[model samples]
Target: MATNQDKNHPQLKFETKNNTVNKLITVAYFITIKYNPDHFLTMFKKLYNKDQLYLIYIDHTCSIEVKNMIQTYIVHLSNVYILDSFYLQTDSHNKYKIQLNAMQYLLNVSAKWDYYINLTDDHYPLKSQYRICEYLSNNKEHNYFIYYDKSRYDLDTYNSNKYNYSGLIALKEATFSESRIIPYMSNTWLILTRDSCAFLSYSKQVDHYIELYSKSLLPSNSFFATILLNSDYKRIIINHDQRILFSKSEPIELILKKIKSNNHFFIRKMNLTSNSIIDKCIEDNYQLPLMDKKENKNELGLNNNQQN
Candidate 1:
């Protein structure tokens, strides 16, 4: 049933689960992978449940045969709804646009879910889904979050930052730009409320801002966190955003100790390809690193999507 996307599936609208009213946690996985269609699915299946809704988007860069194979497999599953058209997120020239596009697709498809998780094809949750579901069902007051401030680390000058693409102009803009800019950082992976989901729904100015900044930028995800924290949201608390590093170049044990030193909740930007990353995260026993979020929450519950 899979035709060339441009041939017959030109107008692509991936269908989500038919209904969603009782599920405790709904995770939207918008992913673009380099190879092996099942590379994404294999990771997803280990952490997800039949009750949790999945709206999958594949890239057209893959062979139609491969695309068909993935689509056929996903559609047959009850909870995993198959999206027909595969878009290209691999082309370097359009990476930013396609990444955002994938996210938008996931958001629209997930219009009927509760919790929304944005993850890379490589991200896999280490925590037990049941444990997560139980915790979320019981505690409904906080926002899941993570943040880093290059400004706080004496690197506000920009030229010294890791990628060095951002510089004095960016710093001045964040400090005194008419936009009243501020800088925040995160690992790009996140689990957020439907409220946060709707809040992140792209607006003209927001998208414009993103387009302006994301061009030629190396770490778009880091900038996104800065934008969100500076926004009206207040419930965000610092959760660990580092996947425990096993690269001997950086000590994983020391980093875990540093993370636990702060008591943060979640971590990200992990080599989810590795079995050890999941094992390391679980070894922490759910004792997360964290920071106070009181200064951040505000009139941010935009009342955006009402009847999902």
Candidate 2:
């Protein structure tokens, strides 16, 4: 039943008009070598509407067929773009480089957008796009970067003794160098402001950290967090990303509870099975237990016009 058009093109039609309910959201979708182009096309269809823009990064390690498919199908859409391919290495320093390259590309081409969110194909939005943007627009000043000080632990001794193997053995893994400005770091799934995007793109401090952590494992986790923490934006950081999971042990019911509770906007590491569940939940208008929300007086003025 697959027509030639169906075989070659995505099922959903891409939209161009900008009718977003809140601020424009620019999403960076980083695709690894093994990502299914067809599945991605399906997800893209769901995520990209008139209001949002998608910048997709396909790694050089992806097959020629995959690359061709992305070029032929995904890029032709009005809102989707392809960043220059970089080598995506596993358990290596170059893994971080892959992310940074995509980030730089996104920053260079994006002229305007309120929030920049990094995503992989596995992430699914728990709320409608409107709700996601409205929530962020309401809290526009906060940087959704989860940060924690690591200097308290003896990382060097742990690294030397091989107690908790992270499976990220690269050129060399060492303790946090005393030279590091701050002891805070986390993975790169961040939803930060345009100002933070510009800062990461152009800041000399970030460049220094990039070079310093080039030899470290998965520096994307540390590079941006370290720089943002040391910069003037430190106080605005919320130390949490609603989209990420702290552990796989967190029960699915607990996760669904959180989503119903309206404590999170989106979640990551989803596959076909959970994706179906999420789609159904959203469709049925399910409501999780409500968590207490503390409104900031300063954030109240962020979208005051919405009040009137």
lDDT against the true structure, each candidate: 0.49, 0.56
The superposed Cα distance between candidate 2 and the true structure at residue 202, in angstroms, equals 0.8
The alpha-carbon RMSD values of the candidates against the true structure, listed in the order shown, are: 8.6, 7.7
**What's the C-alpha lDDT at position 110 in model 1?**
52
**Best TM-score goes to which candidate?**
2
Q: Any idea how many clashes model 2 has?
A: 2
For all candidates, what are the clash counts?
13, 2
lDDT value, candidate 1, whole model: 0.49
Off by over 4 Å in 2: 1-11, 14-36, 90-92, 154-180, 233-235, 244-250, 274-279, 285-308
TM-score of 1: 0.62
lDDT of 2: 0.56
